[model samples]
Target: MDLELQTERLTLTPCTDETLLTYSTNGYKLGPHIGMYLEELKKDASALGWGVWLVIDKQTNNIIGDIGFKGKPDNEKSVEVGYGIISTKQNKGYATEALKCIIEWAFNSDSVNKITAECLVDNIPSVKVLQKLNMTKIKNDNHMLYWQLNK
Candidate 1:
């Protein structure tokens, strides 16, 4: 599915092969980690339906980052979400708005019972984002914090 999610200040477009290639090859402002995500999309069939998405600044009309599910929901009807914003776009609450939009979309599906996320424990901003979304701190390890929001 070609999914495009819009928030108050951003537009999130699903990362298709053509778009990913263009962003990776050209001097687009996306992060380098996107290449790995592109490879994962290529290898996973589920990614075609619910994978990487490009985050755009609606006001500037520039791609600021990306957010998406790791894959389709599991047998447990749960799925994991991940996101990133370029350094220039951080601290604007754009990530939070985009996440709220995506979470709403995911939960709207009957197949989804819960949404999950993991972030570096030391990344206070990301931790705050997860907390702002009301996702419970389900677990944590030496380096990462795991969060979940049940529908």
Candidate 2:
């Protein structure tokens, strides 16, 4: 795993089972109700080859959040990037930094070409990140807006 991605103010690395559990349950305990989904993520990571990772601040080495692609790509068309920042770290631009790093890696990888992200239509903050990345809004299926990144 390429766990040592160094950004201007952040360091990125893959998450372990214990750390992932802590992140998810802690995130859930605070907000977004994410605890129910942590197990599924753990199971999938165990069975699949890739999983989310931590974005650490360089100055403090504190974990900001987890971000990465999960599951197999559909017919190898595109890989989905999933991410979440700790409550205290939100709105400070850390997610964008981590996301750009991961997306750059995905695009450079042999298995992926285009990239995709799904966010609730009402999730304004996430939508802004995609926009900042220059992802196009292709369509909305149910309540999820599908955003795409392709060159």
lDDT of 2 by residue, 1-151 (tens): 4546778888776655555543333332322323423555666654232455577777665666777776556685577788888878799998888889888876666677888889999999999999999999999989999998984
C-alpha TM-scores of all predictions = 0.84, 0.76
Candidate 1 has a TM-score of: 0.84
The alpha-carbon root-mean-square deviation between model 1 and the true structure, to one decimal in Å, is 2.7
List model 1 lDDT by residue over 90-148, tens digit each.
89898899899889988887778999999999999899999999999999888989999
10 residues in a row with least lDDT, candidate 1? 21-30
Model 2 scores worst on lDDT over the 10 consecutive residues at 27-36
Off by over 4 Å in 2: 17-49
lDDT of 2 at 19: 57
CA lDDT of each candidate?
A: 0.81, 0.71
lDDT of 1: 0.81
